[model samples]
Target: MIEGLEPWAQQGLGAATGLAIGLLVGLERGFKLRRQKEGKRVAGVRTFSLLGLGAGLAGVVAETQPIAAAVILLAMLGYLAIAYAPRLTSGGDATSPVAAAVTVVAAFLAGLGNVGLAGAAAAILVFILALKDEIHQFVDRLEERDIHAIARYGIIALAVLPFLPNEEMGPYGAWNPTKLWWVVIIVTGFSFAGYVANRLFGARHGTIATALIGGAYSSTAVTQSLAQRLGQTKGGGAEPAGIALASAVMYLRVIVLVAILANRILLPFVILLAPALIVAWVAGWWLYRQAEPSDAPAPPGNPIALVPALGFVVFIAIAAVAARWAQGQFGEQGIAILLFLMGSMDVDASIVTAGGLPPDLIGAELAAIAIGGTIIANMAVKIGVTLAYARRNGWSAALALLASTLVLAGSIAVAWLRL
Candidate 1:
């Protein structure tokens, strides 16, 4: 907005922005000290406003006389130190003084013509100050495991990711170390997020809600969890519907991941997968209505185990090599078979493998079939998981998933004919 403005106008605008930022901080401070005796208060809205204005004027002079600006800031800080000395002696908290210091810095930045940064900093400071109690309460709720999980993720994302090379290496140049690690990061991140949500909000709702949240990351894990709950309760009927709902969410989640990492094949993939997605939801809804109410499924284990994360990277690396080999050896047919087999255990690995390939290596139709086949195989695996974990009590969950799989199969067939 200031792009075409004259120099004097820009300076004027900067000064105004600084004053506004100061007024905003001062208002919060004033509210906190509203009950204090007027004469005893060290700072107020008017004082802050004047400080902002003075700082802004000093900044204008700094463009031609930088030493003057430094002197002005030092003099202001000196006054603040003298005024706050009594509070320090009385052992009062330093929040107010620290806030005052921030206000000065932010206004100085605004005066230096960084109005956007100054405004943003001032707003965030106010927000943090306002939420002090809530933030403390949230911190109090953090378990040791939660803190460890946070630190682990920080390492995975911030420490490790940036250091990995982006170039494709290994056999057939099929594996890009950076891309493979990113898959692990994204998949692990999703699972960890679901774990956190389930911990915080799962018990408050019930099995269905837990399924909904868990399904976004790993429907298979959700199935196993709910199936175990069903076993303990001997046909706690809600587990079946919850399992189905998680699978439904999985379909949507798959499409979303596809959209994020590989959009070229998205249209055909969605077309073939849409019917299954709808069927899963419809079947889940029906089963949910028929089942008796049940408690929330037990929380799943933390999904961030380092060994498993490293193992997944290995699997993705293998899948990428195998996919490239299959495409070369048997064309689309070989790749389709490879994808189906891989998807039975881990659909995400197949996705990463396929997404990493050159776009022209497989047309959209074949990509849809390969990914759709994985979904079908994954559903079949979940059905087996239900029966294996829940025994006879899991028939409802098995039936619901079977219906969706049948629908998905039919959709795949239709898509095949069009090819």
Candidate 2:
């Protein structure tokens, strides 16, 4: 198509690109201003279209006479300021001319070889304008603590992270401050998302919804929380179902993390873990079906507070050092044992350590064994915590959880035997 066009037509095509983008934006603005008194709108479709055309023409002139193009742009800006000067002085229409100013600049850029950027900015601006009500509502719902939590996350991820040294610092060169902080960021970010979701929807949706959302952050925490609720309610069967569902979600979460960080070992890990996930899901679903309906309050507060994020960073660093030392001293078997011990406390830290290990020291087979051990150990911890905390009414839930774990164990045994 370009080959068929004359040189003048080719240049016209470039100008047309700017014109089309301007028209798209102008059309949206025109619709928005449709109900406004005709003269009240600062600029609508026709005004914006002409502005875009002038900008494009200026850009074409810039190729041969840059100074002339500059003057033309300045003239346009001057005209816009004069046009809105009365409104600015009146103070009745406090609406700033910033958006219109930006649109003109975008139009200039669209002509000056930045059409994509101009178009994207215009589109995003339109979207923000359209979502004004929703944005306001979201802000209105945010509590002081929620704002603080967001600031804390920003400090950790943005302020503190970049200053951390990237070089390995301690314990067999296992601790890289930058890398460790990044892991903290990823984990904390994930937990923050779940925390936000629970806040937004958990009250209306109840136990099952809370379980699923909270599970993404820390299934162990969810399990313990739900178990405590069970004790309070005198063995509400639905609480057990929520616990089981959270556990099931944990397995899938591990699979995703492994696939992302240690993809080569994912198949074996999934083979050993997926059956357990399936068993837990089935048990949870059955329990949900058997239970009476009840409201499960939203889990309290953001789980990714600053102190907890720091604690997790310390925990993960310790786990990584321990796994590295163990691997060096007793090889893969040592790693397996350390991972299981660590997993009993925090499966995420254990799995992350296993995934970060050098492939030579921990091949697919060893990583799989270590990961499997951690998972089984974590399951035991969950069961024990439930039984211990919910002592009065958790017996039935513990039994159900134990049964699921046993079924998972059987599947793992079968997998190992086949191997």
Candidate topping lDDT:
1
What's the C-alpha lDDT at position 185 in model 1?
A: 80
lDDT of 1: 0.84
Off by over 4 Å in 1: 24-63, 72-107, 117-123, 234-237, 291-293
Q: For model 1, how does the per-residue alpha-carbon lDDT over 1-419 read when each residue is reduced to its tens digit?
A: 26998988989988887788779878988888899996888888987777777777667678888999989888877888999899989998788778877888888888888888888999998898787787786687778988888888777777888889999789999877788888888878877888888777777798888999888877888999998778767775688999999999999989988887668888989989998899999999999999888779676667777778888888888888888888889987787778778877788877777788787677778877988988888888899999998888888889999999999999999888888
Give the alpha carbon lDDT tens digit for every residue of 301-366 in model 2: 576678878898889898888888887799877887787777667777776787778877766765
Report lDDT (Cα) of residue 317, candidate 1. 87
Error of 1 at 40 (Å): 7.2
Worst 10 residues of 2 by lDDT: 92-101
lDDT of each: 0.84, 0.76
